[model samples]
Target: YAASKGAAQGLAAGIQAGKGVAIKSLEKLGVKYFWTGMSSEILKMNHYKEVANLTDVIYTAKLKVCDELTYDNFVNMCEQFDIKIGVYTEEVKNALLPKYAVPNALNRIVSEAETTAKEVFEAESTRIAAEITEQQTAVINATYSSWQIAITASVIAIVVIVLIMVIIYLILRYRRKKKMKKKLQYIKLLEE
Candidate 1:
């Protein structure tokens, strides 16, 4: 009975090791399959096509898992060896679906990019227009100020010229009256 129990324990350990290897292999295969499918789908999209095509050669060279065994292959192998493995359910599907669903994610990203670009363009255009208007206003104000200064200078010049002319006329009148007074005194002296 002790020998039989030891054999059962050994068999159980062997089965566990086999399951571990199978699970590891399946995980690698699943990752490769997911990436390959994603790459193919991305290459079909307009925006991602160029980038995906650039990396397509690299992906094909690196992701060489086409001959790897899948779950079905593992099951078939188990059948050939006459081993039975039971299936179990987990709550990972819902979590993984939302995380790996690329279509909706890509659509949201593109929509956000387009909206952001439009807003940036509008803001830049408005900024440029405002700058131009401000510059034009400055130029108009400068011209008006220059015209006012010129008009003021011209009025000042005219006033100065008139004052100079009036002073010269008064000086000439005073000199002529003094000369006439001297001539009249001389004439009176001659008559006396």
Candidate 2:
């Protein structure tokens, strides 16, 4: 259970970090320029709001329960954010930026966001798997050591029992021989 929670937290951290990176990329590509630009009043209000709301969405999503469903939901949110960001970029580019630079810039922003997400997912999942494997290996080694100790103890116990049995047999045989010798001496005395 602890491991599961840890995994969830790790995933959430990765996703949140990825979201921050994506947002930075958007900012670097002049996303905020469109927001505060002089012609911004003419633009569809929802486009900017959607882009702005992304930070809130990501922040809230990260705080949710860390589970598979939560992770899936995050991925879906990222995809949606990607789409919304694309639309916003397109709207801004057509309204403000020159044609020659629009396509590559737009594509780059979206692709960077997607690539960041994929990288985060891969890196975090791999780290988690490695952690689990390391833990499992430790457990296995501990169990193997316990088995070795148990076997060693059993062997020592068996050896001690065998030694005690041998000692008892030797004592019994000596006592029986002594008794026989005494009987013979008595018989010899009777004969005399």
Candidate 3:
């Protein structure tokens, strides 16, 4: 039994050693392929650079004939050369004035005018609102004054009516007493 156990331990150790060796070999193979791929990419970049240099030389040679071209010929030549026209840098863009300077100036003026008109509209609206408030206050004051006048008139009318009624009652009482005294004197003479 001890011999079999020792053989099993040795087999396990041999398997671990084989695995380490396989892993190291795979690592080395990966590194070799990585460098090979990098070299190929570098060679491709060099070839592209050579091609670009050749194209630049051809383009320079074609530009020599530009000064001899007429209007239609120049347009054809530019088209054939794939020439693009524009400011390609900030310095050139800043140095050259815009072609639409007048239109841009007019646009700015129009924008300012719009802003001023908006401000004026807001001011007019505020003024109109103030006027409306003033008119409302005036209307309320006029209504209150008219109500006061009407109430005063009503109280005066009631007082004048009460005084007239009191005067009429006193006159009626005086006339009734005078008639009763004359009747009493006539009765006494008849009895004698």
Candidate 4:
């Protein structure tokens, strides 16, 4: 009987440890899955096709088993410990039943995870949106600046061309007037 009890204890301990590990694993997977989903949404919104595709792989593999795993672990541990302690009272059953307690604990864990994920997603989304907007604004400003420079240079070139034409016209008009004066003098001298 003592050996049997020792074996039972060992088995219970192993089961508890295994369940604990599973619960932790499930919790991590659930959180990571939630975060990946949020990040994927953001990536899609930002048009990051390649990166979003990569995240999709993780999304497919990540499992959301937090509730089921936690519930099972809670019930099994409660039963095992109650058995070990030889507590089979109606009061314990009524108070610490799986149906009553698992839901509450599960709800708390789910709620906490959701709240934290939402806060993180909101903050990250806002930051990324602002960054993209800033980058777009910078690109637009650069394009506008280049256009302005080109227009200014074109206007300057046009003005310089117009001034050169005006200068050439003035030089041609002055030479023609001097040539006419010489012709008039020669005619007056010949007439005299």
Candidate 5:
């Protein structure tokens, strides 16, 4: 930790020195500007793919629902749309389920339990949806937390194993030294 801190401090100092030199050079050149590494692609693409997929689910749910949608709405949406919300849900369902003489759109509507936009979401279904959402959130959070705890436990276990090995090595070394001492003493006594 100390070494890491020292390295960070050294880097900070180097950056500060570079900044001062850069400022002087810019002043001499009669220029003053800086460009940042943040681009639209970086902001849009990086660290957002997971959130992006989630957003698509949420957006689709929004279009299907006139009222507020719950987490269960998203879950139901996944089940209703494309058999599993695939990139080719419409195409696949159109080829398969639509062949049943029942349109895929009608099946989705029936599955969604809505006769019309006025009957969009049920109160009971909403309550159940909220509960399901809460449970799903808990599960995802628990999974991530469990993994972190497991990693921590693994690190502790490794440290303890190393400590045990070092302790065993020290004990063996001490015993060997005592045995050598006793052997030397017996040889000296015989010589005497």
Candidate 6:
């Protein structure tokens, strides 16, 4: 898009009455561009706001409960304001994690870090498991489809054979990986 604009500058409309961008489209995507001739100085002042805006969206600690929020809510949070989700998630007084008994401030930080780490690990595990399950189902469905091809007449026999061969290759590749992971790589190595 940038290259197209640069090379076709003559075809481009100047920033004027009908040539300027409409706020509606920009608002829909939640985009903001504060372009200035002195970009370096402009960024020096606005960069902190940009970081705060991003951090507010990613972190729940800045949120509050029952605070009607939309896109700009993120910008508000980054400037050290309270966020709605912060109130919701903070309602749980206390529970397990025996290390929470420590009275030191550093211990509290460690506890929070451990909690965040556990959440991250669980999320990753769930994502990977879901991906594996989806791929496994696809492979199984493809194999089933290939098996159905066996009923076709000799005219379609070659295509069915190719389909079956492909299915067999996929199944063997999956099994080979499992074998390497479980039995072969540990001690014994075997050939196909």
The most accurate candidate by lDDT is 2
Clash count for each candidate, listed in order shown: 0, 0, 0, 0, 0, 5
Query: What is the per-residue lDDT of model 6 for residues 72-117, given as tens digits with 9 covering 90 to 100?
Result: 7555433322112122123443432212221222233334434443
Candidate 1 clash pair list: none
Worst 10 residues of 3 by lDDT: 81-90
Give one digit per residue, the lDDT tens place, for model 2 in 1-192. Answer: 436755675666555554555456655543443333322321332222233334433323322322334457655543343344343343333332223233434445546645665667667766776778788899999999999999999999999999999999999999999999999999999999
Candidate 6 segments whose C-alpha is farther than 4 A from its true place: 1-103, 152-192
Could you tell me which 10 consecutive residues in candidate 2 have the lowest summed lDDT? 41-50
Clashing pairs in 6: 62-83, 63-83, 63-84, 64-83, 64-84
**Candidate 3 vs candidate 6: which has greater lDDT?**
3
Per-model TM-score versus the true fold: 0.42, 0.51, 0.33, 0.48, 0.29, 0.27
Residue 160 of model 2 has an lDDT of: 100
Instruction: Please give, for residues 1-192, the per-residue lDDT of candidate 5 as tens digits.
Output: 334444444444433333333333322322211112212222343221122233233333334552344577554543354443232344444444323322333234223322221122233344455666677789899999999999999999999999999999999999999999999999999999
After the best TM-score superposition of candidate 1, give how far the Cα of residue 56 lies from its true spot, in angstroms: 13
- The lDDT of model 4 is 0.48
Candidate 5 global lDDT: 0.44
Point out where model 2 deviates above 4 Å: 1-14, 30-106
lDDT at 177 for candidate 6?
90
For model 4, the run of ten residues with the poorest summed lDDT: 46-55
Error of 5 at 20 (Å): 66
Residue pairs with colliding backbones in model 2 are none
| lDDT over C-alpha atoms for residue 139 of model 2 | 95
**What is the C-alpha lDDT profile of model 4 across 1-192, one tens digit per residue?**
334444444444433333333234334434233343544333233222122133233323322333334567655544443332233333555444433333344344344444444454455555555666677789999999999999999999999999999999999999999999999999999999
